[model samples]
Target: MIAAAALIAAAPAVLALDGTPGQGAALTGSVPPGTTLQLDGQPVAVAADGRFLIAFDRDAGPAATLLATLPDGQRIVRPLSVAPRAWRIERLPTLPRISQPSAEFRRRRAPELAQIEAARDMATDAQGWRQRFVWPVRGRISGLFGSQRIYAGEPGAYHSGVDVARPTGTPVAAPADGVVILAAAAPFTLEGNLLMIDHGMGLNSAFLHLSRIDVKPGDQVRQGQVVGAIGATGRATGPHLHWGMKWHDARIDPLLLAGPMTP
Candidate 1:
């Protein structure tokens, strides 16, 4: 299966790439140590061992380029084709419900947004991005990433995370080793009790609508460690864990990183 996802041509002498190059996919690659890497002209972080990670967003264009500049002035370019997926789109005949935000909501939401932005922007030394991710909780998938609904010709925001339906208080585990960046002390307007973890390499995970948070900011958590509990907090309708991930600004599909869930 991995071999199938790794669609690449001849690897250059200075670099090699692997993993899926599809939209919403993450690719891991390596280059000669000291090689500088860039994706679409943006500098990408390369570990001391030459390893690096890059990803395509769900709405990414058909192609991108990776440029590696070796220490000896050698340059290698790899053009990537991003395979697209058909998103699940639901259309309803009713008019979209638009409501004016309350003054209180507007006042409170600013700080919440600021806190979330600050958490995701933090850089940490955690190496969990190199590890294979695991399911935080196993259950029926309630919501899918990139799925959207439309009402009266108006398109709603696409789902940003994969939601697993579970009973309230069910423990949620860390998908990979990470440093806790934000463990919300109270429920936010939409996220409830949110927890953010930095897995390094510009990749991070956000667990939302949690009933309880077992970890706190600056805590180092390992894969499968309990970090929170499932809940119907925030704007959710029922108990579930909203597991969202991002590689820099690109929203990621947790189902891709963790693979098939098993008992």
Candidate 2:
């Protein structure tokens, strides 16, 4: 992994790229204010403070591109390298046809999908992502990001978050400072009692399978503040907490941000 302070000389502009370049990496970087940043020919949002986040998809290519255009019209292009990762796949014979959602399930999921997209689309310059992230709950890890299940020779959807095995009613805290954007107590079809928080600049965290939610939309929460309790709601088979994170619409690894968990 490259250091965050690595400087790249691009003739007219010296761009400093923070964070590693890999799958599920939410890299932060800075350019001159008013500079337009582009990733893979797509326009990327830059905060007023000159901070921008670059997100790598789980199956991103081995190489990527970054284009920066200064206020004076000078254009800088830098190619990026992305590292690949192996995923965990579980084979199940008794698994239902999860890959195909029923009409009723799809109808009920439309609004939920919209809400999740809305929460992730939020962008602010508060730098909440700059703070270190801590584990929301401590327990044995049962699932991981990008892991998938195979049923009857068909691959199902990848696991969207990391699952921590814990007893019911275990307190779940905010991994970092953020404003609550979603708090649904009733168990959904899949996510169960889902809660989402926006940590400024399109970075967000989601807690799933919660038994109870204490925070509501628009509520400010500090790091380590209790927001919910663990449970086996939704499709979970046992009491656990699913912690998912994202930068904009790109799904990132929460374990990467939280670092190693202590026993």
Number of the top-ranking candidate, with TM-score as the measure: 1
lDDT of 2 at 121: 66
Q: Write the per-residue lDDT of candidate 1 for residues 58-95, one digit (tens) a residue.
A: 89999998877788866677878889999999998687
What tens digits encode model 2's per-residue C-alpha lDDT throughout 55-109?
A: 8877678998787778887677788889888888788877765556789998989
Pairs clashing in candidate 1?
Answer: none
Please name the candidate that would achieve the greatest lDDT relative to the true structure.
Answer: 1
Candidate 2 overall Cα lDDT vs. reference?
A: 0.83
